[model samples]
Target chain A: MSRRTSRWSVAFVAAVLTSGVGVLLADPHLVLLSIPAVVFAVYPHLTRPPAATLEIERSIAEQDPAHGQEVEVTVTLRNAGDRTLSDVRVVDGVAPMLSVRSGSARHAAVLGPGTETTFSYTVIAKRGVHRFEPATAVLRDASGGVTLETTLAADTELACRSPIRTLPLGHTARYAGSTATTDSGSGIEFSRIRSYRPGDPPGRIDWNRYARSGELTTVSFREERSRTTVCCLDAREICYRSSGDDSVHAVSYERAAARELLDAASDAGEPVGVAIFGVDFTWLAPATGSHHVATAHRTLEDPETLPIVPPTEWDGTPDDAQARELRTRIGPPTTVLLLSPLLDEFPLETARTLRAEGHSVTVLSPDVTTAGSLGRGVARLRRENRIDALRRAGVPVVDWEPETPLETAIRRGERR
Target chain B: MTGPIAIARRLLVGVGAVALCLGLLVLFGPPVESAIRWPWDDELLLVAFFTAALLLASVIGPFVLIDDGSQNQNQNQNRNRNQNRGNASPGAPERVPSTPTPGRELERVLDSRWPASLPPVRRRRIRRRLRRAAIRSIVRTSNCSKETARERLERGVWTDDPVAAAFVRAGGGPDSDSSRLRSLVERIRFPRRARRTARAVLSRTEEGEHR
Candidate 1:
């Protein structure tokens, strides 16, 4: 669409006033003064609006970027029409969640027929899948009287996943698995020798004990049990709080942690489940398989399940129903790895509730709180109090600050 | 009739063009001899006069008299078009400042009310919030009841600093009219007093936690 700017209307008004006064005064010079104004007013109408046919292509240097890495985005605009475009202003529609760290996303240039211009910018990669919007090009004619605005589409996406360096160690569950337990059973590691009983396997009997005492005795070994872990991610809008510039929300960190926890559990051949508590409760029953892990990751990637945009309006109440649903799903012998920012009281309550339900709950809270404003200071103090309360209740809480590496935080958690 | 009008318009445009060229020549070209009188001097003057009238009308015709309705519609259309394209970055949260100092919130509140005397109600509200924080800190660290914490705060014995204690002490009122000058001094020292009080409470909280 094209529209006139009417910028030279002042020239026309000046011309008429001068001509009217000249006629009344009968002065030829006054009339002559209106000539330039007339020319200025008519010049714009003579030139036509720019015929702009632009094709834009966007390219990202690294589509799969590491967390917090700067990625370069280049946009190439080609004037595909036969007419020269005198003034073209292109504003690239960068993803809303991503911030441009360097360079310009908006460019203004003069493009002749069959010419192209490229502009590059750097954006700090955040965790999540970010898709770029179309570029908007505003083309103006030489007269500046008319403008034509058009949108050029280019599909580009940035998927940044934070790598997990350390696996969570020293967790136990029921059933036979990799890690050795204290229970005496038929395993490689010897525990103690007992009096031999009927129906005991000959291989299980301790041959050395039998040879030494000439008595029948049964041998027991330490049991190996597979761990059942549930990586529960808090996706409520309240968990979307973030502190400092260029930082992703706490929900994003929780999602990343959940992904890593799932991978670790799956690798260890453990039955792992994922619970996403947001606007709706999404649950994946505990199971062990590559497909289950892939499904969990895919669910985390979907915006509907865990959105990049923080919800603006919500019920603003505690998610008691969601917590009830989760508690019913997880029982004894299953460890619940709760990843949350602990911004409000609900998460603390939820952790305590789950712990009270006989489930082993370990909270990995990513600290997104800052200590500047009175409100923020109070928030930080309250969060510390919450963690302290949880610790006093015998629930181990890992206070994970975002600036530190996840592995280091896990090690610190293990030590405590 | 249409053909005759068309020919007249074309002839008028040609005369205007010639007169414009002559005007430019007179402004920027070599000086013409004022003594050089021409045979068609009156006719040349008539042509210049007619050209100026025609040019003036042409300049004013489309913009002043005939463009009112169309221009507004065009502007409305352009605005709508821009609005349609403005949804490219919807729901993007604003980036927070990287360097935010602790107590900046209190600083902001005080700065916004600078120069103007803070209202008594606003002062009470700020003091109320501070008192609540002090009480919570005291109750947690000292393992005392909330009532006892409140009582300690009211008695101005919660902190070692007298200024901080008075800042959040219950029943702390504005100075009497007799001490008008002294009250002015107190108003000037409000921000500093608030900061000191906050620091004292926070320090107590920290110390209690260590203990």
Candidate 2:
């Protein structure tokens, strides 16, 4: 019901009416000039809304893609009504986080009855699931006087999954796994023979030794205990800095390493938990099972539970409340795998405090500091100094370079 | 000269001139007196009127035809040129910038190795870094404030190169434009399909010449 007056029509109508009246009363010469104005005034009404029948269908090239892969989305619009649409502008609603890699999500075309047009664009897949919104189409008549905006709903989902890889635990996890444990017991390696006890297992009785030595002895193997590890991620504001790309951010690397460690620990039948310290403050208690693994994945994937950006500045001072909170959550028998960029002194102090509290500490610091500029060079030096100080204090520290895989870095750190 | 209004004006001037000449001839010449005293009533007057109208039409007709012919020729020429531009090859010399000085720094910043296959988060970070650097470079070189430079860059005021300008505007993020630019740059740099596009572009211009 919305109507807009055309300026040309208004001007022409006014001129014709005034001239026609003047000619009737005074001069007949101006009567012939009003003929063109009458024709101009009738031209606009010839255009109609192009009947309201349109069918929109959306299709995605890949519903599930690896992170960093490109997905192409095509939207096909057909004119179902019995009319020709002169000017139609269609804009497909692309997810905000998904970047268009190629082509365009918009198209302008003229479609006749039963004719179809399609517009497509490529989007870079990121981690998480993205849903497409409705496409908006604006139909304009031939005279450009009438515009009808219609929203067409198109439901599509694109899920980007990150491939999980096992991270090298090195000498940290003492259990029966790919990595060897320092204190080996009940393993393949033979240890020593001890005097047989009355209730000793029949299999452990060294019959060959007893036959040779004539003294009753029992074979004892070193007992291998599955290592229970808690991954402590420092998602504090100070750990949010990136050397170059956001993907190369300190916290992102820490998160990746933590996930890998959790996967490796879970595979080895070791109890693993995650504690994210920041504004979000997410803590998962030590547990082992498929349910716990699913819970960890869910927590890591949820945007609310993870810190994407720094919420506050780290002043390099100790927060007693935070330390106390961490201490209460972490048990004594569990090894604390502290993953931080160690951007400031606070994380270093936290590592020191954890070690002092009799918890075995392994610090995996992702190096996001570059020495391209003096400021960054100083930051790198400060980070190195912190790593040195932590190592000197008997804490196993892994200073991982961003380019190196997490597993390789941990193995290298263990060897050192 | 070729428009409908121009043709109408020419026709009006031609008719006015013919009418004025006829009026002068009738006022001073013996033809008008002879025609007035003719035994055949108004037959002579009708013939003179028809003769004058024919003369006016003859004088104005050629100009109108010539104008129309020339207008059609010009339109055909323009259409051909547009078609040629649209069909130009990827290595077309015209696609290369004439003087790439303004975009040199931005190009260098964007020239960093950003592959499309990298994770979306990494790609976004790389794009953002390149964009910020480009904006800062624009501010420094153009002697404008950061806000003005950003606005200009976003609006594509600094560079005429659409891809380079788009690269600046699509600051590292998950937006469609940024993603498109990143993909374009990756293709241009690595070029699995169009491998010669980058080589053809760079080989034509000297590297230091841009600086």
- Which candidate has the top score in lDDT? 1
State each model's CA lDDT, in order. 0.72, 0.60
Residues B1-211 of candidate 2: C-alpha lDDT, one tens digit per residue: 4766556556755765665565455557866645644233455554554455445545545554564467435433432232223222212111111111112222333333453344555445445544554554455445567789789767976654555556546542344556777665664543121112222222212221244
Per-residue lDDT tens digits for candidate 2, residues A114-175, read 99998788877755455554665667787766556666776777766333344333235544
Residue A195, model 1: Cα distance from true site in angstroms: 24
**Candidates' interface RMSDs, in order?**
8.1, 18.9
DockQ computed for model 1 against the true two-chain complex using alpha carbons? 0.11
Using TM-score as the measure, the top candidate is 1
Task: Tell me the tens digit of each residue's lDDT in model 1 across B1-211.
Answer: 3565456556757977898887666556645423323334465565675577667667666765566557656544443343223222232222311223323445565434464456556666667767767877887788777799889988877789998898888755565564877777666676666667777887888899899
* Candidate No. with top DockQ: 1
Compared with the true structure, what per-residue lDDT tens digits does model 1 show for residues A101-172?
A: 888888999999999999999998876556676776788988887788777788788877545554453354
After superposition, candidate 2 runs with Cα above 4 Å error: A1-225, A245-248, A309-319, B1-211
